[model samples]
Target: MSEFLIVLLAGVASGALNAIGGGGTFVALPALVALGVPPVTANAVSRVALVPGSVASAWVYRREIKQVEGVATRDLTVVGVLGGSVGAGLLLALPASSFDAAVPWLIAFATVALACGPRLSRTLASSRGRAAVLSPRVLLAGQFLLGVYGGYFGGAVGILMMALWSVGTGLDAATGNPMRTAQVTAVYLSATVLFLTASNALSVPGHLTALLTGAVAGGFAGAHLGRRMPARLLQGVVLTTATAMTVLYFLRG
Candidate 1:
């Protein structure tokens, strides 16, 4: 019962966080680790669990999907997907400790980016004077790298995507929003496929039955509520959760 409650609460927290932003794994991963799952396994399980939530959030944001225009969207999504697959493959091949040391730094960078993202976007937009001039090869390579990072350990991947889009692609923050969502969706889809195919999902203390139940229920609720949420409020929730999770995870590490 204790384990069940823990997983359920974790699922609820992760779902809510995901609905608002994109750091759901930051919550779920630590909870799974505390529950006695190995870090790699915990990561894999968390990734699997996150799929439903991302799908749900994507559905809720479907209306905005059409808002993303220009040729860059298709190109970026492909780059993200390819990058995500490679990252997931790397995670499955690498030792857990290899990533452990890097996680904290990544989280810190992401947190800082989330906090200053809006200001940075405005400043960058002003400087660009219309379209952000990006080297196609460089942007694609960067997106691929980011996708890999997202597949392996996805916390605040959205912030990274937004930053990249604002600086590299020269899009307004709001316009970049759906692109981030779409990119994340593709990355998660690829990661989930890789994780499942590799058959490396973590076996924790809690039962799959309970975990799935709680995660699905929470995901559904979050998706339903997210559509009606005010943009400012949603951004607030995302920033707060991302910052808190980064701090907590750094301490735990």
Candidate 2:
């Protein structure tokens, strides 16, 4: 019962944060690790379980999805799928010890990105038409790399994607959010397929099912709530959670 509740709450928090912005992995991954799942397995399970939440959030913002200036949406999606598959394959192919050692640094990097990404995006966007000249190849390359990151660990990938789009296309954070949601869904969708087929997520059906159920519920509610919540407030909440998670994990390391 305790195990179920812990993951369920984590899933709710994770899905809600993801629906509003991103950082679902920060909650879901840590909670699963705390439950004695191996780091790699936890990462895989979290990604698979959160797929529905991301999909739900994407559906909520479907009407708002639009093309980024320089790159075609289909082109980016294809690259994202390919990169995500490679990342998932790498996660399975590598030794578990390597992932354990890298967890703290990965979380720390994601924490910094979560903290600075929005402001950085805005600043770059405000610069004298600089982002307007961003090349399609550069944008596509960045998206592919981010897709790999999303597949591997995916802490604040949505924030990073938004920053990428903001800098590459001079798009505002609010305006870019729907696309961020969609692309993240794309990355996780491909990653989930790989994780389910190759990873150990199936071994813990109890935990996986609990998290998925909570995420489905939370994702729906959060999408509706996000419209009314202030962006700063949402960012603050996610940052606080991400910071605490980063510190706790670092100390654990």
Candidate 3:
């Protein structure tokens, strides 16, 4: 019962965090790993479990979704799917030991990305004279890289996306957020297809089910709360959680 509760709560937090910002994997992945799931499998399972929540959040933002000035929505979706599939394939192809060794570093990188993303974006925008818009080729290329990172580690990818747009196009985080959610959904949905088919992520059906259920509920609630909540407050909470988790993982190692 305690284990079930832990997984369920992690899912709730993960879903909420994803909706508010993007740090769900920092919670869900570690919780699953602590319960004895292998690192690679935990990653695959986390992506699978979070899909519903991501889709839910995306739906809430559907009407607000926008393309970058010169980039088409269809092109972004297609590149995202292809990049995510390739990343998922890479995860399955790599040795488990490699993933295990890389987990701490990955988490640390994500934490840094989350913490500095806003500032970095602002700096980039200022350096670009504050009115610069990215070329279509640049946006597409960046999104494809981000999609690979999202599928490979499944953490803070949305934050990274917003950062890219903020830097490249001077888009406010609030305005770009819905589009970020949609792209995240696309990346995770594509990755889920590979994980469900090729990975052993389904081995722990009970845990997965609990997480999926909680995530769906949390996603629904978060979408509503996000409108009224201060994004900085939510982002701070997630950053602290991610930082602590990253430290703990390093200490454990």
Candidate 4:
């Protein structure tokens, strides 16, 4: 019962965080570790748990997704899928130590990206004009790389996606929300496939059942809230949470 509660609580917290800003792993990963799951196993388990949340959020954003430029959306999704598969393959081949050492730096970079994303988007939009800057080819390529990153680590996948979209797609931050959600959905789906098929995700502890359930429920609720909430406040929460998690990770490292 206690173990179940732990997973449930972690899931809800992670779901809310993921829906609002994208660093839910900060909570889920640590909770898994504290629950005595091995680091590698915890990473895989967290990804499994997160997939449902991302999917739920994507569904909630379906209406907004329809408004995206059709060509750009299709192209980016394709690129993201291809890139994610390659990234996942790389993850399976690389040494775990290599990624562990780099996680802190990546987190720090993601934090900065989220923090300044809005300002950067505004500047880019004004300089190149929104449509001109957001070329389909560039957006596709960038999202592809982000997909790989999401499959491999996925800690700040949402932030990275938003930043790339802001610069490469030139979408207004609020307008880009659905794109970000969609990108994350693609990455998570691709990663989950690679992880499961490769047998790399076999270590998920039974205790995580409750966590998965809560995440699914919370994700549904959070996504609904996200669509109705004020955009500014949502962005602010995401930035703040990401910044705090980045600092925490760096300090721990």
lDDT of 1: 0.70
lDDT of each: 0.70, 0.80, 0.79, 0.73
Query: Quick one: best TM-score, which candidate?
Result: 4
Best candidate, lDDT: 2
Predicted candidate 4, C-alpha RMSD = 2.3
C-alpha TM-score for every candidate: 0.84, 0.85, 0.84, 0.89
* Model 1 steric clash total: 0
2 against 3, candidate with superior TM-score:
2
* Pairs that collide, model 4: none
What does candidate 4's lDDT look like per residue over 21-95, in tens digits?
A: 678888888898898887776777788788788788788888887433424567777777787777777767775
Cα lDDT tens digits, model 2, 139-185, are: 89988998887887777777677666755665655566678788988
Q: Estimate the overall C-alpha local distance difference test score of candidate 2.
A: 0.80
Ranking by lDDT: 2, 3, 4, 1
List all candidate RMSDs to the true structure: 2.8, 2.8, 2.9, 2.3
Candidate 1 per-residue lDDT over residues 20-54, each given as its tens digit: 56677777887887878877888888878877766
> Over 4 Å off in model 1, which ranges?
66-71, 133-138, 168-179, 202-206
Instruction: Give the runs in model 4 whose Cα sits over 4 Å from its true position.
Output: 66-71, 124-134
* Residue 141, model 3: Cα distance from true site in angstroms: 0.9
